[model samples]
Target: MSQTGTIAKKDALAAHPPAPPWAELDASCQLPVLYFLLSGLAWLLVGTLLQFEAGIRLLCPDWCAVCPAMTYGRLVPAAENALVYGFASQMGLGIGLWLLVRLGRTPLVASGLIAAGNVLWNLALTVGILAILLGDGTGHAGLEMPAYSQWMLLAAYMFVGIWGVQTWAHHTSGPYYASQWFLLGAMFWFPWLLTTAQLVVVTFPGRGVLPAITGAWFAGGIQHLWLTPLALAAIYYFIPVITGRPLRNYHLAVVAFWSLALFGGWSGPARLIGGPVPAWIVSAGIVATVLLLIPVTIVALNTGPVLGSRLGQVCENQVLRFLAVAVFCFVLVSLGNALNALRFRAAVTHLSLNEWARGFAYFHGFVALTFLGAAYHVVPRLMRRDWPAPRLVSVHFWFTIVGLALVVIPAAVDGLRQGNELNDAAVPAVKIFDQLRSVFGWRVLGLALMSAGNLAFLTNFGWLLIRCWTPGIRSAVALFIDQSGKSVTAR
Candidate 1:
């Protein structure tokens, strides 16, 4: 009860030191996080295959003429929904939740509920995809899923998102990092954006052009507000750790964060520039899209030095290489968006494959790559094992890069050519059609390669899980034999 007694107690506790906080947190999160990751990778493979199928349909219109569900209209929307809702959203949630708990130094709250919600979310997405294939698509860009399915998705998201909010709240007294801010913003922004879009476009079915306007806005918000922020959250957090250097331009990260938050939602209407929507809305979108250059510039400058200093590491580390590619794609996508939003550039790119090329680059090249890098880093920690095969990872990265370049470059270049020719009445329509056929052929190849990459990743993920749980499996078998001379469940 004296000072000497207290000092001796403290010294003993320090020497022993209970398990690290991250170890405890990772143990709590293993079930739900692993479930999310596994489901996400499965969906990634399914989505990529669907996309490849859609590309084939584009090239050969009569490829699947007999099957109504395989029609181009149904297939395209189905593929997009599968990739965005099924793959990207699920992966982002898994990665974001882990980042939230790790950066906040807090235990996961309501992990059981998150696991249940994950099941519901995937179920709802499955229903939505089937609905689209069955010709029940809402005919909206991002809101193609039917009204009933949309509500279910929203309900499921809340179950997971609320816990994220609570985790951040539990650590409110601690200093917040840029990554936490981005993750928090994404968690809050998606539901609001999805709800508003559903209300205007699907639930209420606004008058003619209004639904179009709402759909454009919703799609843009998904890209800029939801997906972009989720990707950046991982980028900001992992780059420094992977490079073994502190984030440079620390002060500017705040500037980048606030700038992105302010500008993202307003940039959606740029898609409707030449449409029936009011001119002011279009102007606002264009202005916001251009202003996005601010954050884009800040991000490049901020992370550029850290990445540059570790060029050798970037080449040596697969995850670092992925992150580096993500940064480059982010800059490219932002600049392309700004330039294409202009009146002249929009005139050429508005109704062409140029837009599709940009979307592919942004979604697959930028966002998906960032999430993949984060997954490579976090999965090992959670599983308590390193990747079983490094060669598979290298194959995945190269396939992704080469495939993306194939898809984006050919489609973009040909799209501009097609646009310019279409504008000039003198150029024959057949000429543009021929060029499109070539690009579609290239896309088919690219999608095939990308799908192969997805399979490689999924296989690696499965292999890692087998390695991680093998020890526990052996322990269980040994313990069962010692206790009861049988490996039967105890009643």
Candidate 2:
């Protein structure tokens, strides 16, 4: 994460009055977000390609399990790392740096430290990604980084987090900026959640049942408090940018944030529903999961009118087109999660392909759509370049949407079929092979479409990258000295 701004302009403004100077961020943040979006699209392509998935499951005389590196076990985690770290986390860090400067209306506190932290963060993710492929993961999704790397990462985040919090304190009074709230909230949330989870889940020895509880706590907290907010912050910032309107109910934004904060921790055990975890623990999670509907409904209602009643207006802007799609996906995923929490529906989907379908929908609908929207709005602004290729943009969006549908909807249906066959218990174990066969072709088709979509996404992004850095398209890069505080120049 790095900051870019017009200091000469910021100095001129700050020289004038109480309002702080707001500098636009430099290309550093843009670069990582760009690269990862492309890379994530690449992995998204791979996950859907099913070429490897098929080969892993078959072709060899021996079973794939013997080769852990090539198995779905490794591939799934590795693919997810591509998304969570390669794509989302880096993008989040990059954007968070920008928002810290812009919303704070001041320069970053420790430019060098932020840069160093970013380097370490990327390095940690790199080690973590390879570790996953090598089957050396800590066995946690978000915490896949080995323990040593995580320690370095932990120290690194402290620097960036300090920059964010200091900059936030410097921001002036205004209409409560929802994006700022999310950003500041995230400044507090991520590390706290990480450290808390680390102590209980990793550092402490709570083997067996106790460790399970701690593990659930760690995972759910990360998704809800850390990752969820970054996605929401992006949503809050970009949706308004696209719709060209304030949230329909600004107060509801507060409600949604607090609601998520209050109830987010006690959920997601709906995920491990059939497992051997204690019943009350699972029931508590069920209740919290269901309660999440309140925040979800509020978010949906607030955005719906602005985005919903004026669908044409919303999509008139291509950026909003993606955002509108993400918002709809958010609503769908939230509602689905609520429904999925119910015992009835979960009975048919527990640990099955349907589970994957739901996850895919959430990933595509909420996280991917949000980031795609972010990319569309961000790239042009950062480079000050003419829009790259309208045809490519439209094609990329359509491909992603269609590919998501193919993967999520079909997998969800197949998951139901698979779960139903297995959960019935009356069906002999011998029939499990038949159930697996039914979903095989669908997985293959879905992966192919997904790969096509990713290729389109990467093509458009790569073209923009080439065009932006070209000499002819160059814009004068802006820099300014920090007057009010010690110079924000990297140490």
- TM-score of decoy 2: 0.83
lDDT of 1 by residue, 433-459 (tens): 887988988898998999999899999
Compared with the true structure, the alpha-carbon lDDT of candidate 1 equals: 0.86
Give the per-residue lDDT of model 2 (tens digit) for 1-491: 11123423323442336444322344434444344345445545554453436423643426656766677666666666666655666566566666555555555566666666666776776676677778787776446666766676677778678876876787655555777777777778778877765666666646776656766766666667766777778777766555556678878888888888877878856666767888888888878888888878887877788887668877666677777788787778777777887888888877787777777777766777777667665655455443557777777777777767766776677777787888778888678645665455555565566566667767777786676555333322222332344333321
Best by TM-score: 1
Model 1 segments more than 4 A misplaced: 1-20, 475-491
lDDT on C-alpha atoms for all candidate structures:
0.86, 0.66
By summed lDDT, the worst window of 10 consecutive residues in model 1 runs over 7-16
What TM-score does each of the candidates earn? 0.93, 0.83
Model 2 Cα shift for residue 337 (angstroms): 1.6
Q: What is the C-alpha local distance difference test score of candidate 2?
A: 0.66
